[model samples]
Target: MAIRLDDITTDITLEIDEDVISIADFQKATDSFLGLVKELSRAVSGNADAASWQVKVYKGSVGVGVSPLSSGLDSLRIRNVMVSGLRALADGIRPGEFTDKAIEHSKSLASLFRKSNVDPNVRIWSQREESVRVGRSVAAGAEKLLAAVYEEDGSVDGILEKVDGHGKLQLVIYDVLNNHAVKCEFANEQLPQALASFQQRVEVVGRVRYRRDGMPVSIRATRIINYPSKPDIPTLTQMRALLSGSAST
Candidate 1:
């Protein structure tokens, strides 16, 4: 004899045997069970106005009813049975494994959110889109010269430098794509002029030396010249469209 669980509206019917249950059936049941937990939580949170819901379980069958009723006794009985089923399911699924995976995924997402300065409370779909945009922006910034070491005479364009307290003109050039920074030293003769163009795009011609850690320790600038400011980057919507192979707005 085989036990069966059925939900007519969802068109779900599955055999409930420990040895015979397929992976697909298990996944489907897990999803359905989690959804039910969410619905129950919402009801408990006062988001649901229904008077009652019903759940039934027997030796060989299970059923659910999400309708309203005037009385609460049936609802209480249904809740008890649902809890028992959830406990059994939890034991079968070894929920600790899923919990561990969920924790790891959350940590990764939190790290991404921190790097992108995006709020985690944003809509999940919007967060996904924003994460992709952030990744592309980082990639675009990294492909620039700032991320690489140029031991030879090389020119880096569109960087802003500032003067330090020691009266030396210093700046940290960042590779947004690679999440790295290169410290640069401006020629003493260029300090006066570089300070004048503070926070504005400037071109630096130099021989660069990198540390063993792959960060540029210094750029020995031979000359400095003002460069044009960069144009505004595309908006998230435009980036998304571009990434999706559509015309960017």
Candidate 2:
């Protein structure tokens, strides 16, 4: 890929086993690195096609450049997010710091350390940031978070449509915000509440687990607040008339 210095792009360096790399290694590294970046690009922008990028390679240390692909996505933001993810991974990113998708993607690129003839540690850095090294130590730190899925206090508003009474007593709520199913776990005491709100639009307040791409996967319900269904909700004319009466008073 051809890019200029003045372009709205960021240059990052990937130090490999050798300054002069073999074609096989180059292809392997290039495919892995670029594919990781594009995956992240899509994650950041939520546009798979817009993940396109213009990359440049520099001599010495297998330097790589990240530039916009005219897809209107912010390349600099993409580059910074990548750096943040790598650095966070090396330092052991918190559960809410990045989605599992991002971590898995990072793990893919970091797997370079496992390659033959590759150094025990793989180093990468952008022109404006310090180099981050990934290897066994980083992996050790990463596995801790990956093993225990990050759970955080959050809420989701959705329609409670599916309920499983046989097994663990799980409920599947169709998330209104992201248009996806969010598995919900509720206390036995909340069974009545869940049943009453079944097949209705409700807000599930509790812990939400979200994918890195902003899709919610599950939630542990502390409370379920049901919203009035469309038929029960006042129409525009009724709302306007009520407001008009209040104003007249």
Candidate 3:
């Protein structure tokens, strides 16, 4: 016989006599139940917002001769076990900070499972996305100011300097292609090397902070690569003056 639940259908059979249930029949039932759970997990995992989801079995039975026996029978005990396992998996997820859109999408996917005889639902696990110390990457050409964001494979050449009294490190890079200038910040550990390579071309890899006006304000560098050969790049002061002059005009 076959059991159909929503889009999942599996063939299952039960054999019973005046004696004990056959081991082969028990194995077949367990395998089918597990297969259904696997399918549900795959469908939910594809959604980026999914924190946790569950599969519930309300009623299940197996065909015995011309009749059916309830899943509670010793031979059919696997059904209850599988449902318990699914619940444990769903409850394990911890809800942290997440984007509003991501959370909404996750809820929507969970709602779909409510229409079936078995109720499978997804729960929002957490609102937290990433730690404060870590940085994330943002897309280019965004108008809104982005903080602690990095650009993949983004390289900058510039002069490095430390503020005399503030103990802050700064790097000014000029984008020749766009005819613009950018500035970034460095960690205290990176200050010594940047000072040694002062006024030299260097590559910076890190997250950036942008101004509300769509201009890059600064970068928090995670890695710094020095280039011995000076590229045809302008100094930080020169770029600043040039930008200032352009703004005034």
CA lDDT of each prediction against the hidden true structure: 0.41, 0.65, 0.37
| Model 1: CA > 4 A from native | 1-150, 165-168, 175-179, 211-215, 229-249
Give RMSD to native, each candidate. 21.4, 9.1, 21.9
Task: Write model 1 residue lDDT over 49-91, tens digit each, in one string.
Answer: 3323333332433322233333432344334333343332323
* Cand. 2 TM to true fold: 0.47
Ranking by TM-score: 2, 1, 3
State the lDDT at 24 in candidate 3: 55
Q: Give the runs in model 3 whose Cα sits over 4 Å from its true position.
A: 1-155, 159-167, 176-179, 210-215, 230-249
What are the clash counts of all predictions, listed in order?
1, 0, 10
lDDT of 2 by residue, 121-199 (tens): 4565655555566555555545655552557888888788988888777888885654466789988998888888888
Question: Regarding TM-score, does 1 or 3 come out ahead?
Answer: 1
What would the TM-score be for candidate 3 when compared with the true structure?
0.27
Q: Which stretches of candidate 2 lie over 4 Å from their true place?
A: 1-10, 17-28, 95-97, 113-121, 148-249
State the number of backbone clashes in model 2: 0
Q: Candidate 3 lDDT, tens digit per residue, 1-249?
A: 222234222212221111222455344333433343233332333223122223322224332211113222222222232233223323432123212222222223323322245332111111121111100111111112223343433445454543332656666665544323466677788778767776655677777654444445566678889766645566787689888885344
